[model samples]
Target: MTDDQPEEWFRNSSSTAWGFLSAGAAIAIIVIDAATGWHPETTAGGVLFALVAYAAFFRTKVGVSEGDFVLHHLYSTVRFPMAALESVSVGRTLGAYAGGRTFVSGAVGRPLREAVKGAKREHKPLSNHADFVEDRLNGLAQDARDRRGIKRDSDEQFALAEDVRRSWDWPLIGATLVVAVVFAVLLVL
Candidate 1:
């Protein structure tokens, strides 16, 4: 890393609220179970639920570094080289498409939308931070493409982006489901 190297940009919008809430809920459940003589299984299930919530919602980081788009989730990370990136699409969240992979940012953009709605309800205008992030991500993607090469056709890029968007996070989803099922079983028995 040097001054000439592009600075990394990172976003983890759910850390403050989601992280604290999940942690607090976990701790509270454990404490209450201990004091009230709840079954140990119930405590364990509550803790596991808290862990799942923290992992899925709180422990996420999305960024661009070293000419790669990075998505950091609870137990995995996916990276896509900027050279391979076709474009970025942002809606309720941010996504970078490259090499048939989509790197999605955690929870973002929603706060900006809520702020905008609040302002509108109060008859005031609101500054949108999501737009700034979208612009920055788009600029980085373009810069990456330019640095890599400019020979790619628009149709090819579009196809690749679509493929990336459609790709699913099967591992994480599966693990979460397993945890939920186990927790349910523990509660029932």
Candidate 2:
């Protein structure tokens, strides 16, 4: 809250919850199709693959921790000094610019949330989930310009910096790998 304190906060993507729900849906569809014998093996396989690919969108995120802007991209978790950040923008999805104007998908919006919540009232927005998340991320980015060069007690800042710079979202990556192995076994069997 103060200029002297480090910025720390996070916003979760709806994709995370929806991705998990989608995985379950994909499995159920496959099982039901397997029983009905309605689709060919190739057709089922192709569809499942597409569904799984879409589920990878779950990893996206945008946050600020220890005066650093963190982005959880599909391939990596990147953290940079908030001072280097240029701006956060919203369109169909959330986006940001940092370090000489390189754009990144800082966050993503999910319409699937509407399907889970059911139809909204006549006055309510259909894309409320996406809109809410985009607004929060942009709001944080707007106020975080002062966090660029926060100094902490000796060694702590170094450790935090290293941890942020080197860390990956290992837990998600591990779970994904485990599920892939299980699915492979199921397919082979």
Candidate 3:
């Protein structure tokens, strides 16, 4: 773990177990589809989708920890010398369009606010993926702050960190979605 370089975090044993289970499910899907010998293309698409889901759930990197900080899905790793961290801010709306449908559309504001609304509508507890990632980042941020006993994240800094966490995740999610959509299209055709 060098100061500036983030050490990639691999999936743990539980993740490995889940990966195996998911692989089994994928195999089962293929077997059933082959036995039926109908809609092979669609079945193949399902298999590919399952494979992608498996990779995402089991293979995606969790966090990258460097000397200064650790970057989770949305958050950046800690501050290191020469690491020009511009700013961190929290965002409400993370807009995206795919298949002519919007996912996670929110009014302009805070992610927490949107999350709360979602929870209420869905009748479930708040599921803030960004906040979950932020918790991990906060751990690292607090550690760095403690080491120096100097407060770095002012209101602006905190917001910037929140924003970094929110914005950084879109590209990764978008890439995954693109891959999945392409695979689906190829299979359908």
lDDT string for model 2 (1-189, tens) is: 223324554444555566767766767777788777755553346454534545364656666766567777765677765544555644445566654344556355344444345335222334455555446555555455435342332243334334335366665566556666655665776
Candidate 1 — which pairs collide? Answer: none
What is the TM-score of each predicted model, taking all chains together?
0.65, 0.50, 0.41
> In order, what lDDT does every prediction score?
0.61, 0.54, 0.43
The lDDT ranking, best first, is 1, 2, 3
Q: Write the per-residue lDDT of candidate 3 for residues 63-177, one digit (tens) a residue.
A: 3455433222221222231122322222453322112222232211244555466535332213644444334444544554445344553443344333222234454556556
Candidate 1 per-residue lDDT over residues 55-105, each given as its tens digit: 767656666766556676666766655445666655566666665555676
Name the lDDT value of residue 188 in candidate 2: 74
**How would the candidate models be sorted by TM-score, starting from the highest?**
1, 2, 3
The candidate maximizing TM-score is: 1
